[model samples]
Target: MKYPIIIVTTILLLSSAVNAQKRSAPDWVLETKEAAWQSRDSQGEANEGNFGDVWYSKDGLDWTELKSDVIWSKRHEQSAFVFKDKIWIAGGAAEPDYKLDSEVWSLKIPKRWFRDN
Candidate 1:
């Protein structure tokens, strides 16, 4: 009985030490609550029309910003999906009276991109 207690106590101490070593600086995560601009009108209040910034993460918790201020027009509430082995963005509105975007954009991610990352 004494040997079992000692073993359990030792295990607990080692576990605590391991957990302490794991503690590190917090990670930065981006969340999209609303669009870019802030305006008084109903259109402005709506969560639409964010700038062109792309972020990617293999694990959802940790994210990396791939690019910022992309060439594409900044918009929000857009349709994003994976089709034809490519990612597509379509039909979103921009700021200033929430103008609509008729254009569609598709990105063909190279096969090597996934393997190299």
Candidate 2:
């Protein structure tokens, strides 16, 4: 009956999860908190999506919002994660008419998280 179908579905889902993990290696788990932070800019975004931010997951369950230090005021020019423990953002439309640039900017985090490098 319907009860049997429900039990079967639950078993299949649980088995699939166990099998998937059987193929992966284990690493440091962060168990991060959930948060949302802003990224880049939206002044020149398409319709409304003006920025790109990232949600960090340590245990693949909770997420943390990683934020940037600046907002881009122009169009097209992407940003990316460029280093360990931080992000690098650059390349956006500025004044002087649709120009391209190689200028890169690295945003700073709190001094406590800064390691000797």
RMSD of each: 16.1, 14.0
The lDDT per prediction is 0.39, 0.36
Looking at model 2, which ten-residue stretch has the lowest summed lDDT?
23-32
What is the clash tally of candidate 1? 0
Best lDDT among the predictions, by candidate number: 1
Instruction: Name the best candidate (by TM-score).
Output: 1
Q: Which portions of model 1 show Cα errors greater than 4 Å?
A: 1-49, 68-70, 110-117
lDDT of 2 by residue, 1-107 (tens): 12232333233224445533322211111111221112334444345433333333333333344544543334345444435544454566544455666545553
Candidate 1 backbone collisions, by pair: none
